[model samples]
Structures are given as structure tokens and as C-alpha cells.
Target: MLVIPAIDLKDGMVVRLYKGEMNSAKVYGEPFEFARAFENYGAKWIHIVDLNGAFAGIPKNIEQIKKIRESCNLKIELGGGIRDEDTIKQYLSLGIDRLILGSIALKNPTFVIEMAKKYPIAVGIDAKNGNVSIDGWANTDSTSAISLASKFKGSKIETIICTDINKDGTGNGINLDFTKQIAQASEIPTIASGGFRSDDELEMMLSDKYISGVIVGKAFYEGWINLRDIFVKYQA
Candidate 1:
């Protein structure tokens, strides 16, 4: 399994929001340092979310994101405020290895499907109470997480990142069962995100063949998960 480190940028600073709430953002300084550190630890990919972009539907933390891309060797998978072809092309030109469509994917799967065939793309399914959430997770819809994931069955999409929004930044634990449904439904390698807590949680996810990766956020920022140790054990 891949241990992907996350850097969530809110107004150009690294921050983690509790349960996806903007008001609960905990600043952790500039993003450049963290991206470099994660790269040094042997991470193959870095997960970056422009918190401001997600809400505004336009890339807001461009310079901060560019700083990370230029400083680190890590392949970047960026999501947020990327709804159109122009924004997607802009980030790709800035060296983003992958683009994850979240809100737009929920609202228009056809557009997402078309984009997937043309670019290195992934689908982010942020679930709240087992239903897919959108608009930076400010709204919940009737579509089930499994149902939404199944929509990408034969697409060229790279992967599905299933995040349990309720558990994000809580350090409670990852919602493995919730992720499993998405994995099976999508029939694609899925990455689990949000609420990552312990080595035990990693062990459980590692045992699952369908879970290709796990996004570590608050757990790593809080200083418990050793990136080098995790990389050696899992990705070595």
C-alpha cells in the first residue's frame, strides 16, 4: 500500500480542518517545508487540497502550491476548484501529476468521464453519513457513495479516493468499511483518506487488496506517524 502524505492549503498555509469545517482549520505553517520533508521520507506521491479553491471553485493557493511542486520530487495529486478544462490544464502545466475532481464529479459525471479519458485524473468521494458530499463538503446529496463510485466503472480515471468526512481530522480512525464499499463499487484501486489514527488502522487497510493507498493527514501532523518508518515498512 502507498502511504501518501497530505498538505491541505488554506489561504497558503498548511492546515487541517476537523470534519471538513473551515472554521476548525489548524494552521501548521508554510506548505513548502512539509512537502520537502515528505519527499525526503521516500513518499511517491503527495496529496494536496487547496481548501480555498474548493470553496471558491477557482485555484486560490496557486503560488503556495507552485512552491511545493518546485521544491519537491514527489508526484502531486491536487484537488479543489478544478471544474473546467482551463484550470485543469493550468495545474498540469504547473507540474501536478494528477488531478482529482470532487464536487464537479458529483454534479457532472459526464464531464468528469470525458476529462478522465484526456488527463491523468482521479475521483474523490467525500462521504457524510454514507452519502456523497459536495461543494467543499458543505452539502450532502441523496446519491450513495457506492452508487457514485460505480459510475466510473470503465473510465480511464486513475483511482478513487474515498474520504469519510465525519472522521477527518478527528484522529478517531479511518472508516475502512465505508471505503470498502467504494472500492468494490468502483472496481478500481481506491485510496482511503481522512481520520487516519494508528498503525493498526494501516495494518487493516494493508490487508485489503483493493485499497491501493491511504492519505495521512492529522495523524502525521500530530507527530505520531513516522513517514520514513511507514515508507520503509509498507512501500519498501
Candidate 2:
């Protein structure tokens, strides 16, 4: 499985929030340095979230994103505030490996399918309260995660990143059962995100072949997860 480290951007600085709460954000220095550190730890793909953009409904960290794209060659999967096709095209034009549509995917699935068809790589799906959350994880609607994932059955979406909003940044371990159920229902591969705390948690995810990837954030930033050793051991 691909080990994707997260780089959440708020005001052009790397940060992480508790359960997607904007007020609980903690800045982690420069985005450039964070990207390099993840790269050095052997991250082949970087997961970036525009926390401000997600809440504001517009791209908020474009400048830093551009710098990271130019600085490192690691594949990037960016999500947050990507509401329409124009914004989708802009990011792809800049060479972002995958564009993850969260709010749009939950609000207007048709647009998600259209973008999936047009973009070479597209990912969608966000979770909350055992249901799918939309509009930047601000609201928990009635739609079930599996049901929503089934909509992309024939779409060109390469992967779907599913996060347990309740578990996010809690370091309580991923919602594997929920992710496994989604993976079983969805035709496309799935990536598990949020609450990935330790090497054992990641190892449990790795054991599941259906989980295409795992996105690590707080655990990596807080030194709870030693990514360098994890990568080296995995390689061995």
C-alpha cells in the first residue's frame, strides 16, 4: 500500500486541526520544509488539504502549494474547496497527481463523475458520524459512505480517500471496518485516512490489500510515527 503523509495548509503554512475544527488548528512551520521532510522519509505521494479553502469555498493556499509542487517530485493528492471544473483544470495544469473532490462529490455527484472522466486522476469521499460529510466536513448528511461510493462505479476515479471525521487527529486508529465495507462496495481502490497513529495501525491497514493507501498526519508530525524507520523496514 502507498504511504501518503498529509500536509494540511492554512494561511500558506503547514498545520493540523482536531477533527476538522478550524479553531483548533496548530501551525507546523513552512510547507516547503514539511514537504521535504516527508519526501526524505520515503513518501511517494503527499496528501495536502486546504483547510481554509474547505471552509471558505475557494482556493486558499495556492502559493505554498505551487512552491511544494516545484520543490519536490512526489505525487500529490490535493483536496478542499475544489467546487467546479475550472478549479479542477487549474490544479491539474500545475501537475497535481490526484484531485480529491470532497464537498462537491457529496453535494453534486454528477460533477464528480464529469471531472473523473476528464481528469486523468480523481478521488472523492469524506466521512462524518458514520455517514458521508460534505461542504468541508462541516455537515453530516444522511447519505451512507458505501451508497455514495457506489455512484462512482463506472467513473474514472482512480481512488477514493475515506476518512472517519470523528477519528481524525485523535490518533485513535483508523476506522478499518468502515473502510473495508466501502472498499468492498466500491469498484475503485480505496485509501484510508485520519486517526492513523502508530506503525501498528498502519501495518494493520497494509494487511488489507483493498486499502490502496493510508494518509498519515498528526502521528507523523508529532513524532508518534517514525516514518523513516517504517519505510526502511518495509523496504527490507
| lDDT score at residue 230, model 1, on the 0-100 scale | 88
lDDT of 2 by residue, 1-236 (tens): 87788999988988898988878889889988988887888878899988888888889889889999988989999988899889988998898988888888878888788878778555557788778887677888899988998888877888988988889999999999888887888778899988998888767877887888788899988889788887776633
Decoy 2 TM-score against native: 0.95
Write the residue-wise lDDT of candidate 1 on 29-145 in tens digits.
899999999888989999999989999988999999999999999899999889999999999999999999999998999999999989999999999999999888988999998
Q: After superposition, how far is residue 58 of candidate 2 from its true place, in Å?
A: 1.6
**Local distance difference test, candidate 1:** 0.93
Superposed by TM-score, candidate 2 places the C-alpha of residue 185 at a distance from the truth, in angstroms, of 1.4
Candidate 2, superposed: residue stretches over 4 Å from native: none
> Candidate 2 — what's its lDDT?
0.85
Clashing pairs in 2: none
Instruction: Assess every candidate by TM-score.
Output: 0.98, 0.95
Screening candidate 1 with a backbone cut-off below 3 angstroms (N, C-alpha, C), the clashing residue pairs are none
Candidate 2's error at 100, in angstroms? 0.5
